[model samples]
Target: MRYAYDAQSGQCLKFVYRGYQGNGNGFDSKEECEDQCARSLYDFA
Candidate 1:
């Protein structure tokens, strides 16, 4: 799916944001993934 959330809406994950796209927002490289993961939410499965 393009989106998901935890038990609470307080957490969310999206496939597209600020021009990024994937099963969720993806990085150009692994380093970028590591960096963005810090700022992005990924609690949703």
Candidate 2:
């Protein structure tokens, strides 16, 4: 599975499972996605 989020908003947008076309923001896990968003937020801060 994978996850996607809004970089500016730092919010999780959606998830992408196996065998599906993702939006390219997909992550390995929800935690990873959230972590990425957090990092992005921190970077902006």
Q: Pick the candidate with the highest lDDT.
A: 2
| Candidate 2 per-residue lDDT over residues 1-45, each given as its tens digit | 457887676577655477666565778777888887788778978
Q: Each candidate: RMSD to true structure?
A: 9.0, 3.2
Task: List candidate 2 segments past 4 Å from native.
Answer: 7-10, 17-24
TM-score of 2: 0.56
Taking the candidates one at a time, how many backbone clashes does each contain?
Answer: 0, 1
C-alpha root-mean-square deviation, candidate 1: 9.0
lDDT of each: 0.45, 0.72
The local lDDT score (0 to 100) that residue 15 gets in candidate 2 is 53
What local lDDT does model 2 show for residue 27?
81
Candidate 1 structure quality by residue, lDDT tens digits, 1-45: 233433254433444345444354444544455455544555533
